[model samples]
Target chain A: MRARLLRFGPDALGKAGVVGSGRLYAAVAAGGFRRYATYRAATLAGVFTNTVFGVILAYTYIALWDERPHLGGYDQSQALTYVWLGQALLTTMCVMGTGFEEELIERIRTGDIAIDLYRPADLQLWWLAQDLGRALFQLLGRGLIPFVLGAWLFDLSLPASPLTWLAFLVAVALGVLVSYSFRFLVALAAFWLMDGAGITQMAWLAGVFCSGMVLPLNVFPGVLGEVVRALPWAALIQAPADVLMGEADLLGTFAFQAGWAVALLGAGRLLQVVATRRVVVQGG
Target chain B: MDSHSHSHSQVDGSFDESHDSFSNNSFNESFIELDGVEKVFDVRKKTGFMRSERREVRAVDSISFRVARGEMVGYIGPNGAGKSTTIKMLTGILTPSGGRLRVAGIDPSRERTRLARRIGVVFGQRTTLWWDLPLIDSYKLMHRMYRIPDARYRENLDRCVELLELADLLDVPVRQLSLGQRMRGDIAAALLHDPEVLYLDEPTIGLDVISKARVREFLRDLNAERGTTVLLTTHDLQDIEQLCSRVMVIDHGRLMYDGPLTGLHEVGDSERTLVVDLERELPPVEVPSARVVRVEGPRQWLAFPASESAAPLVARIAAEYPLVDLSVREPDIEAVIAKMLHSMRDTPKPPPEQAERSGRAAS
Candidate 1:
């Protein structure tokens, strides 16, 4: 078996090499950057919207606190930090939407998926690697730059320690894995379902609302917040922001995120196997 | 297995001994084998939101053939006749539902990766190379994929470029090239790994005549020099006539005919149309096994069984009637195929009257 695997190594690499050479990752990155660069104009508009919402929410929080020491284990500074982190991470995560789903559906429709099926490499792994490459570019070129600029201009609370910064980087990697696995699992619905785009949209919307994109999950009602905290969607965005803001327990957060990553990765693989079997049975 | 191999060798030895005493004949070996292979597709038709309709489409019915090394075999069929499906099964792109298949001694469906290393495939309608990248970069990527040695890579690349005339187009993005140019590049890309078997599906579908000829010539040379086994599927009969010595005709998911091109022409009662021009206007020339199809102004077109010797008929015409111009046109492949398909539609009918009579007399 080991010998066979070693011999198969070059075949897998060849499959990956064909996909990688297309410069698709670079094009996707460039496209994201161009869209976001033009979206800087929208950022100017978001500035006003953020200021209005922040001031109104801050006032409402202060009035509710009645000068109390802390609310929900967060001091006023930390509470404000949550707001800023939520806004910034929302922009970052939202930049990597399920755009590849349409392409996947089209490929499946046209029987182009046969090419990937014939390759020696694992199809899901190949696509995940490409998506990872695209995510890295978007995180750097589209997400990080604009995020830093927004925070700097607005005087948001930044990470206080290098350890916090390091933790944030780890969290970001886990977050991307979780997000990509979820999106890929959704896209694999094309094997069984006719219109996977609708499913993707619903999943994206659910993730956006439940993962604290519009508002911090802590701001939700007691049961709702607890439910959101338990779901994997929170680990995609909220957990990363928690690390960056030094609000999460380091080891516990890492363990939780790792657990979600492993579970989702396994689920994605299982779904891939089932979907592939279904496709084969369908004679595609 | 060892005993089987020994017996096989012994059979070969005996055959060689018998032939070696007479003529110096070189025999090409079989690289692929398909024994009573069958592939059935379960085509499902979803009706309303709740219920579903299901049916089976036997894309490839029970059929068997072998491809010899260094031989180019043309697989021709009409649309939906399962040519692509058969190619897919042979290349390990699709698994067969039943029977045995082997390529290079490996079951392609079982050891696809190993099989892929020995075979190259080009589906003409699709571009396997990266559309956004320059064609050269795609080739380099493929080189890495197939792990071609640097020296071999350079040698193959140079040879392919020279053969396909792709030097000028290598640096251009695949999206920028014309269809013909892109197909040439695609063919070159598929051959970069120096695979033993090349499966070409509609390789010249959209190519101009010049490009098509260039492709055919390149393929001919490749087969000659490398002894590569080629299984080409094309709608263009010209491609078959020019490249393949053997042809397999499939229709309605079954092998209707599998042999030399001559087998199609020798359907027992082959007919030829002869157009004759007479010096003077007219007399009805009565000849057995010949019918006048059309007559206009000193000219008469006659249809006759080609089995009726053309020499005597021509002599009789020359001796009996004054002729200004005469021409005989062989039946076109298109017409032959059309007739074959028409016969296929009328499946329950006996053989044609002429063929039946000839068979009865022989019996």
Candidate 2:
């Protein structure tokens, strides 16, 4: 990655901004990364909340399994790891979908979207880049801290094999893509809904329960676990956490995540085309 | 997104080179041409609880006009007059519902991104710069966003920074800067790619006297030096007075007047306000032509038709009352537009200029 970064160069990135240019999308992604870094207080707050939640969830799971030998596939220790990893992936999934609602809705309401659309870049890709950056930032700043704190606080078990760790990382990355695609679609709802707060909140609520962040898929009774795992929402939080805990098959989980990412992305692109065609900018 | 016109050729080297053979002749010709252009918005209003009525608002009625290269035209109108709708359609921000619109031989809506390479837009009501980043950061972002060549981007940034007096403020976050400073930053950001045409909407809306003067001067120099076509929408008549040679007056989605700024007085048939002071408090001054619109202690404001010579009214006032002091004020563009809008509502027929527009066909 370091060598490839040097090979790309700054001039290549500048030209990336032209319409239909992939480099432009990467540049925008990097820009989104830099933009999210500006909110230092928010980053710290997110880290704090996520870490605190990880501790609480780990303790709750440890207490839940005091009587049972094993609940689902996870032992008491594995259940604690699941809770910690789930907390780590919380921001990346953007269950509340980050600051996209306010940012997009404000632009739509103010008619400043005129300037946004006036640019040569594709609107969907532009936002995708921003979401990717935000996901990366949350992954690094908030994701890592909670995992480390949970590891220290809970004496958590680490993946024994390098292959397991690699698969876990890949699953987390896919999880981000799945999360971004879902959030991107929800954000587009702002164009149609006068105030998207209700829709956004509902999406967040659905993600929380369905994505296995509230309760692990394995905890759902036999047949219910299969249904939960089949849903794309589970790929965002459950699949990555399950892979990290070695509770799910690595290859199968990766394939399922990749499939969901591609599907959601295709849906987002379609929505973008439909939304752009009949743009009814308010308060012009 | 529509990629039909983008084609990569539009963003390569020289802007003119990318526009192809059609641009060469059209370059010096009518740079901005609109024939029978119109924008109708389907607005929904809440008639009652859980119900609404959909209404089609002809924001920009069938309008036609041609703007030559390097021409600075002022587009002025009262609230909801569709001045903004026209500007939006020109920039491809809003698609026109009817008629044909072209900017440098490119269909603005169909070739929006392609046209973006050659056009710049600034909405003074909002800042395009990144709110959390320094003023220069937004320019740096634009530097990549517009694919402005390195040398040209650097040179333009430096020139704008120097000319716009944005030197020390470069590091200040946009949210921290004053409205005038942010506006200058926005203007600089727009010009970084050296666009051939610029659309400025209320560029001096909330600016102070000194800042407004600076912005107006910068626009004047930009037009004179670079020959950039300017279409300005402003409520401040001074912006038109100082920068534009011609002005287009729009009202109720129709072109009420389209001609020279000097010609506006005749078209609007404006009025003049004469504040007269008598030696003592008086009921009102009796004048044959002028009527006292307001009266204060020892002072009275008389309204007289601007078309007629003010000399006769002054003579009549002086012959009747002992004048302490008197001064005449020309009818401001705001007042002229108000009168124009009122007179326009009184008649069902379109303005004389608009009557001839249906004769012109789309290119």
Candidate 3:
């Protein structure tokens, strides 16, 4: 990026830099990172809450897994690991919180989205970059510490190989993509509905149950298990945890996550086009 | 004559970038052209708790005008007069429902992102700066977001900082800055990319006298030196008086008057207030062709036609009453627009003498 600064001319600042530009998105992502990093108090509070929840959920899972050994094809250690992973990922996936969608919805309500549209960048890509940065920061600031604490205190299944860790990281990234795309679509609903608070609540409810955050989708009964596992929300926590536990085929889980990410992102782009076509920014 | 004819041709003809030099040929091409552009919003009203009625509100009704390159024009209107709607359509935030609208040979809605590269907008009511970050951080984000050259970005930032007097406020977070300071910061952010045209919506709305003067002076220099086309929407007539050569007035989503500032006063039948301080409290000043609107202790305000000279009224008042001191105040643009809209509402078509007065004033 600094190399481009040396070649100073009008050509260096041309429209070509805006189309499929890596540096532009990276800079926006960094901006998002810096923006979230400013809320030191919020990060500390979030990390504390996640650690408390991890302890509570780990004990519950230990009790249940002990009653039924090898339940849902998982031993006691796997169930406990799933519980800790779910707690760690609660904020990173933004399943319960409104996340960036809260601010986006407010912007639409106040007609401040007009300023966002006045920028010389793709709207979807700009927000996607911001969400990716936010997810990464939350992962480090809120996700890692709680999981490390939980693993130290409890008997948990730890990944034995580096390759599995690498695959887990990739799955986690794709998980963020799927979740962001879904949230982006929900945020765009504010354009037509003029208020998306109700829709956001419904989305959060679905995410909590279907993402295997409260309990592993693997333990659900016949039809419910299959249905929850097939949902895009499952890609956020269940699939990533499964990859880390080395209980799922790497290629198969990735394909599922990648497919949902592409489909949801494509739908979001379409909705964005339609929504911006006749934008009715709420207030004058 | 050559400039006027060329501008006319540029508006009527297809998009042409041949006369793109902004400095040398200021009026040789039309930078912004609108032909009967309109915007209608479908607003729903809750007639009852479980029922509603959808109504189509025509916010911008077939407004058409052309702005030449390097021209600083004032767009003044009432709160709901569709001035903002027009500006939004021009910026591509709201798509026009009918007719053609072009800014620098590009349809704003069709090529919004492309056009965003060339135009800058400032809404005085809202600050675009990052609230949590320092003032300069927002500019850094824009620097990369717009892909501005490092040298040019630094040059423009330095120039804005120096000219806008933002040297001390650069490190302050936006949420902590006062309204006037944040406004100056926003103006600087808009200019960092060196856009060719700027749209300022009430840039002086909440500014103090000194800050307003600073902003107006900076804008004047920016226009004069860079030949940047500026479309200003302000309720303060002084902004138009000091900066713009022409003004357009909109009322009820229609263009009511488009001519020189003085012409608008004549056409709208606006009034000027004459404030006089008498030696003691009097009943009222008796004068023909003027009415006392307000009277306080030892002071009185009289309203007279703006087109009439204050000399005769002053002489008459001095001869009849004990006048200590006096000054005449010009009517504000809002009052002018309100009076214009009120008169137009009374008579669908303008009276002959009013038309003749406007015609003479236009010349």
Among these predictions, the greatest DockQ belongs to 3
For candidate 2, give the docking quality class from DockQ: acceptable
> lDDT score, residue A146, model 1?
45
Q: State the lDDT at B67 in candidate 3.
A: 87
| lDDT-best of 1 and 2 | 2
Q: Model 3 over residues A1-284: C-alpha lDDT tens digits? A: 23212222233366775343567788778878777898999999988999888888888888887788888999999998998899888888998965889888888878888888888766788889988988999899889999999899998999879999999999999999999999999999998888888999999899999998888998889998989999999899999999999989999999999999999988987787777765654666
lDDT of 1 by residue, B123-235 (tens): 78877766656788778766755667789989999999998999999988788899999999989888888999999988998899999999999999999999999999887
> Residue A48: error of model 2 in Å?
2.2
- Residues B108-151, model 3: lDDT tens digits: 87667777888999999877888877888889888887778999
Stretches of model 1 off by over 4 angstroms after superposition? A1-96, A278-284, B1-28, B44-54, B268-335, B344-363
TM-score, every prediction: 0.75, 0.85, 0.88
Order of candidates by TM-score, top first?
3, 2, 1
Q: Candidate 1 lDDT, tens digit per residue, A18-119?
A: 454334334434433443344455656655565555556555555655676566666666666666555445434542364455566666656667666654
Q: After aligning candidate 1 to the native by TM-score, how far in Å is the CA of B281 from where it should be?
A: 17
Better by lDDT, candidate 3 or 1? 3
